[model samples]
Target chain A: MHESPAVRGRRIKKSFGDVVALDGVDLDVAAGQVHGLVGPNGAGKTTLLGLLLGLAVADGGELEILGTPVGRTLAVPDGVAGFVDGPGLYPSLTARQNLSALASLRGYDAGRGVDDALEQVGLTDVADDRIRGFSLGMRQRLGLAAALLTRPRLLVLDEPANGLDPAGKHHVHRVITGLAADGVAVVLSSHRMDDLAALCSEVTVLATGRVVFSGPVTKLAAESGALDYRLLTSDTAAARRVALDTPGIRVPSGGDRVQRPDADVLVVRGAVPAVEELVVRLVRAEVAVRELAPVVAPLEAAFLALTGAVPTDEEVS
Target chain B: MTTTVTPPAVEARPAPVLRGYRFELVKLLSQWRIRVLLLACWIAPAGFVAAVSLQSVLPADTVFGRWMHATGWAGSLVVLDFSRSWALPLLTALVAGDVFAAEDRLGTWRHLLVAVRSPRRIFVSKGLASLTVLLLLVAGLAGSSIAGGLAAVGNHPLVGLDGHLLAPADAAGTVLLSWACVLAPTLAFAAIGLLGSVALGRSTMGLLMPALLAFALQLAQLLPLPVAVRLALPSHAFLAWRGLFTGPAQTGPLFIGLAVSLAWAVVATVAAYHLFLRRDFTDLTYDGSGRRVLVAGALPLAALVLLTFAVVTATTPAKGSGIERAKVEGSLATAYAHLYRMQTRELHRPDVTEAQLRATASCDKGGSRVADQGPGNDWRCVVSWHLPGATAVGTAIYQLDVTADGRYVADGDGPKEVNGYFQVRTSTGDAPNPLWQFDGNVDLLASTSKD
Candidate 1:
């Protein structure tokens, strides 16, 4: 199997006068997979996306997109499509007209294909509506449709799901999944960890323009120091007994203890799958376990630990 | 996890500027504003010529002449007039002002840069599109002027105020070329608007600055100054177009007008290109770009002002007339006797034969000194003659004004001038004579005797 990256960057740095936007970053996105980049505000995730989209060039190190090597003076690559920051849209143009203009520029025979792309983005009904009237989510979808019209091999999207409702997010996720299934590489930068987790099998967490962690999401969860377990039990004593026997487990203390002592409830921390094994063992031991949930959400906990920045309330959601 | 890779069905190719430009043209042409502007381009010159032509035909008492008559080839469009000098510039401003500014007003500059492949490409494409539109707009104005003039005014012998009739061939050539002269100055305005559009990043300033500059140039030309500064201004081109109508038309001013406007356009366009390409537009702060300071603080305005001031002061007359001693009585007696002899011998009556007139004038005043005829300063005079059974009378007028350089004044006020005609009224009861007038101020380049 080929190990070469479809897109790669090493030790990339970008600065705007007195402001350091990106510093000593490394990233690689292989073909046929979706790579999610997540970070808190000012973490330089958008900067990295800018680098990939050819909107900004790194000040140091080498960057590559698809098979094309890039330098600080590199032009936007031929077959790469995506949005950095937010999509640039002609607000006066109708959705279909915008797509058609893009298609015409690319010399594509956009005939009925613009309609098809609109349908794919679930914007067919509003294809004739001017983009000025579109919601943020709808505009995002239209941008996606524009990208799809070019049939790009590498897609770099920044915070694409920020304004999407559940169904809209689902639709976006499905479309991204379908693209990945067709062997298109996607580099998605988002502030929403849940969205990243749902859509990306592999993830990179950046902090201060450097990648703090990059690998499979499951690996990140497993390697995390501790997993939070939410427990529901018919008998509190039985759940406590199971947890006590479980090695490498700690129960919440102080105000963290919210459950009534006579009723069934418990909270504990351990390795994720290990805690799951313990719960199975407890059920086998005939202690009724009603619910199990992670209290220290792995993605959230990882984000806080990696960034070392306090997660805002919005981020926690 | 194992991933499955499938070969893509197709590869995408990059787009070219030609295709991009076509789309741009489509957008520009589809706008209702552009349609209205084009319509105005057609109507304005036609309407101007029609109005002038109607005035010319109604009454001879009105200050109407062949110059007011629309050129024969351009049908109803009046090619020569004071109103067109200002009107054409305004018409140019109406269209050229909005070229790049419209995009800024619509908030499309950033959007276009992103949607297009690059800003450099966008700049070039948009510039070309604007130039194309300007050409079309100028053509429409010129074409309508020609068409309207020919249609509205009947093709008759155009007797100029000087009693010279412009032939069909000469009039056609002059009107066409004159309209073209307007284009040279219009380009300067176009460039100004474009620079404003890019530098200020607002459409209104783009339009306003150019229009204002053109009007400013026109005002500057009116100030007391040398011929050079007057000729250098963009508005001079408007006046340069007047050359086509005048007898023995001088091409020098037209060439100077062309050169000045071309230089202005080139300098402005180059400056605009530099600022547009170098400025960090990512920030998109319109005012903070520093373009205004650079453009406004340039040395050209100061240089032109100082040059004008120095030239005007140095050239204008120090006081009033220095030759005030050459006054009326002595010269008036000689002038009358000389005038009497010339009338008796040369002027003929309706009933008298030419042979009979010669026998009447062997008078001593028949050959008087030239100086005895009149005072140099007197431009207007009345004289009498004898026609068959009636005393024939007429006016022999002279108007003189020295140049700013204190040059001598030249006098020839037979008929036409800028303001109106000075008629030569004869008392003979013949058909009513066509009155001639001196319409403009006269300045002496050199004396006919000295030449």
Candidate 2:
């Protein structure tokens, strides 16, 4: 559609004392898109999100939100709204009152958009109940509703899926997707690979305050070239023999990454063609295949490969 | 909030500060604790009035309590004076202490900033909201006190500090004016509470630190500091209105008190505002964590206060001993003359006007070695007064407890056979005498009294 990106942050540098939170990072989000930020702990995900929400100003960077350049002062353009480090909600206020308070603070008429926000987040039932007794999931949902009160063009959230149950998770997912459909740009940080795979078309992987990978979700999954395939067959010995005989396949006798608790299953590692050949050979050998699947999901494997890499012993003091 | 297919026409939005201020006001008013504090401010005074009215001994030890039964104005005055001790400081602290810290406590600074965007807007709005509530708090207590006092006690004359009987109307005026004057010091404390909140970033510290600082300043005020030094302290504004009811300009600390008051308020508020601006809301752990005592920030403020004290003390010399010999003489003789006239009228004796009784006093604090320039309970004055046609002068030794602000309680040592006893014989019955123990203020800080 060639729409101008809703957010463009370049070479952003933010530091707290001597701790380098973010060092020369870059990010972009287009309209009507869900952008996932995936990073390990202390990966500057929250710091980046804080900058997007105007909770902080970048010490050294250019950040444009909704096409307006952010200033040195703590501010983003008016249409940008969100929270980092979990949603900062007032426990003393009711769910509805919290939304109303945000609306009032945002210069909207009181109660003008509160009900819509609550209904959007599926919090209408507990709208009038004080949030002090609310579960973390409920508070997260309420925080999302408060963001909705802004009708933001660009939304930034940190760990939105934290503390959410299945039903609440789906509810929030639906809201995020609906907002993206409505042409809002959303940039949310999550440790959950499945959440990013489900909701995000574009994902940015950060490691040590630098972008290790940034592209489509499909591209992120493809970053890992090798696969750990779990193999099970009616004739296990026969299938193992056929898989061992197959080309371009390594079935490790002393297993590591492909290790499984199931004693009857054989673990193999190779490219997609090698695994396909092993499956075909198993059928040809008349060892009926019961199951053959990647032991770790592609996205998780890709995420771990991209962000979970530990520094060498020599790199540490 | 639905996004429209067509762009809506641009409309002027309210200033972000105004919007935030309105919400902050609503948020503050919505809290049950705030409402309860306000209710306590209003309702607690009535209980005090009732308690004082039911007691026969009267609160004679209090500054304005000796005439609690005589007039409602006395009750109001008692509340006005007593609130200064701790109630007003704590009250201002209770309102402003947590306004900023509560956001940090709740981790809602991000939530609020997402809406307001500018921390400056948040700071100004929250401060304005706190000030508004404080104004309401003071007004509520004042209104309730005046109303409760009048309803509990009858409107009668008030015994001024100078020992003159003030008519009920004028007394009420004086009481209300005193209460109104309390706002300056109240604002100064409120600013300190805000500074504590921003700098400390904890609700408990924000609430208690400003109050503790006020107490510390109050203790400093009592240290026989120079009159300029005393007047420069915000705490002294509480006692500044004492001399106003004497039918002249008794507010000697008026100008300096006001200047110091606004200076403290502005400086504290500005310091708080800067700290707020410097805050980094990058994490949810916002309240008093990750930050320790800012010695760089605090030392300058402390130095400013100390420098103000040093400059004023050095520049404005306190030449004489505490409560000048002339002021003590004038106050003792005036109080004695006024009370004697009343006593003579009740006893059906010839009235001796204040001028007819030529009174003189010689006072000293400590022994002859002491400077006698500051406040102390060690003050002793020998007062002599002559009757219109009496041959001999009557002398009495008076022990005085004088405060740094120049108000004193004097006890006269005289025989029961004279009018110096606790009570005096009148034609109708024994009437309470005002001469034996009397309260007076020596206007040492007054412009005309600089000696």
The best candidate in terms of TM-score: 2
* Fraction of native contacts (fnat) of each candidate: 0.15, 0.43
C-alpha lDDT values of all predictions:
0.59, 0.77
Instruction: Note the DockQ of each predicted structure.
Output: 0.16, 0.31
Cα lDDT for residue B428, model 1?
A: 20
- How would you encode candidate 1's per-residue C-alpha lDDT over B283-365 as one tens digit per residue? 43344233462664234434543554354335433112211112221122223333233233323423343222221211111
Q: Write the per-residue lDDT of candidate 2 for residues B1-451, one digit (tens) a residue.
A: 1111222212223347877888888888888899998898888887787678657777777787876766777887777888888888988778898888888777777777777766777889999999999988888778777777788777777878877878888887888888878888899889988888887786477678668977898888677766756665777777777777664556546655666777788878887887788777785556663243345245545666677676656655444434666676677667767766776776678888878877667788788998655678888888777888889987777888888778888887665444466666643235467677878887765433423
- After superposition, the stretches of candidate 2 with alpha carbons farther than 4 Å from their true spots are A229-268, A278-295, A308-317, B1-15, B283-297, B310-317, B345-350, B366-373, B389-392, B419-431, B446-451
Task: Give per-candidate clash totals.
Answer: 33, 5
Which 10 residues in a row give candidate 2 chain A its minimum summed lDDT? A308-317
TM-score of chain A of each: 0.84, 0.91
| Cand. 1 TM to true fold | 0.70
